[model samples]
Target: MLVRVLGSAAGGGFPQWNCNCPNCDGLRRGSIRATARTQSSIAVSANGVDWLLVNASPDVLTQLRAAPALQPARAIRDSGIAAVLLMDAQIDHVTGLLMLRERSTPLPLMATPEVLSDLSDGLPLTRVLSHYCGVAPLPLALDAPQAVPGLPGVTVLALPLPSKPPPYSPFRERPRRGDNIGLLLANPQTGRRLFYAPGLGEVSDAVLATMRGCDVVLVDGTFWTEDEMIRMGLSRKAAAEMGHLPQSGAGGMIAQLDRLPSGVRKVLIHINNTNPILRDDAPERAELTAHGIEVAFDGMEIAF
Candidate 1:
């Protein structure tokens, strides 16, 4: 099994275009400590030939351009993706589906029922795609492992996690409940298993034990501290409130990861722009390295 990091940044991308924040300014100044990243997305290949896109990022076209394999062989309307497995329904995660509108048939999407329901509503994906019938919703049941149609050796398992809608939305009235999820991927042909959760709220012991024997783990690296969004004025809530763990500070990622058994090989994904760790010179990066954790970058490939 081969996993590729297509886009490693969280929403708005690293150094968001309209953002005037210090990080954004630093990136523009060509500071060595700053790095630019596209929106979050990943691709998993069963035999390194056929691949499944983890999420359809807003930068899908560019990401696809970066990887020659995603381009349509005959025309852009063909379904180049074997299938798409959505980790969540966040705008940053699903906006890229628009670029696939040129595809003639509905793209097969594997996701939880709640997530499918949210997409059916006025979420960004449905709203933009409402006028067109290009994309169709295919929901996956929790706990049931589904064999990807084209990927013979790989099977994807959906693990339900607690999640809700944005607090500011009028849709908050009913609020999407239990939509968030993590993935447990396995390639029996290669005897590889990976536990992936790029937007996790809490790390449960059950999940830890469940993934104990996996070869590689890609978990959330959204913020360095709970107050990251507040400090940046991007949001009024903390990272924890948004259902993620800060990679820094007390009781944060370092501490939580400390308890994991040796040899787990943890890598952080869905990194935010404001996190100083994005800078190779930052102390946070060094700390994570010393602790045996890696920060995922675009184009980084993991094989197991």
Candidate 2:
């Protein structure tokens, strides 16, 4: 399996345009030991030729430009991207579909039924894309492993997660089982597994079982503490309220990750710009490193 960490920042990205928080200010001035990151997204390839994008962030155009492997080949308009799998209906995750409208052929998009319905009704990306390069919605079933279309050696399992719907959704009662999900990619050829969950509200028993014995696990690192956004004066909602589990505290992702097998390579992704771990010299970064956890950066590649 070949995995590429295309972007690692949360929705607004690091050094978000409107804010001048300490991390953003330091990044803008080059005063901090942190790298500029786009919104969270990743690309996976089983054969190194045809690739499947995990989530298409708003920065997909720039992200694609940075990854040479995803560029066109011999044909002038040929793209290496075979399909795109959406985890949720968030603007940051699906807006990039507009950028892909210029493709010569229609694109295959996979998402849970709830996410697809939300896009069909409220956001209408599915309706709009039908005019350009059409979007073929492939509905994903929770806990059911399905072959990723056009990618022969790869199989993806969508594990239901506890997360709220995007704020823009027309039906905003509360999140159900399939509103958000995590992906488990398995390569039967190499006996390697990779568990990726960039949006997590809680670590349920199903999530733990899915992550066990995986070669690599990339989980959410959105906030360092439950009250991070509150303390930073960024937002009034707690991390859990925003559908993210913090990395600190007793009932946090860090403690959950600690329980995983030691052989599993653990990584953190989808980090918020306000999180102190973005700073290279921050004590939080040191603590994560001490626990054998890697903080993902844009353009980082791992092959196993």
Highest lDDT: which candidate? 2
Worst 10 residues of 1 by lDDT: 166-175
State the TM-score for model 1.
0.91
TM-score of each: 0.91, 0.98
- Encode model 2's per-residue lDDT on 4-112: one tens digit a residue: 9999999999889887989999999999999999999999998888899989999999999999898758596878899999999988899998999997778999999
Estimate every model's Cα lDDT from 0 to 1.
Answer: 0.79, 0.90
Best by TM-score: 2
lDDT of 1 by residue, 1-304 (tens): 7888999998888888888777788888886676688998999886666789998999988888888766547653554587888887788888787777665556677776666666777475655665664555567777778887777787888887766654434355565544777888887866778888888877777766756767778988988888987977888989887788898777787777777779778899998888878888888889999999899988888887
- Clashes (backbone N, CA, C under 3 Å), per candidate, total 0, 0
Off by over 4 Å in 1: 72-79, 124-133, 166-177
Which parts of model 2 are misplaced by more than 4 Å? none
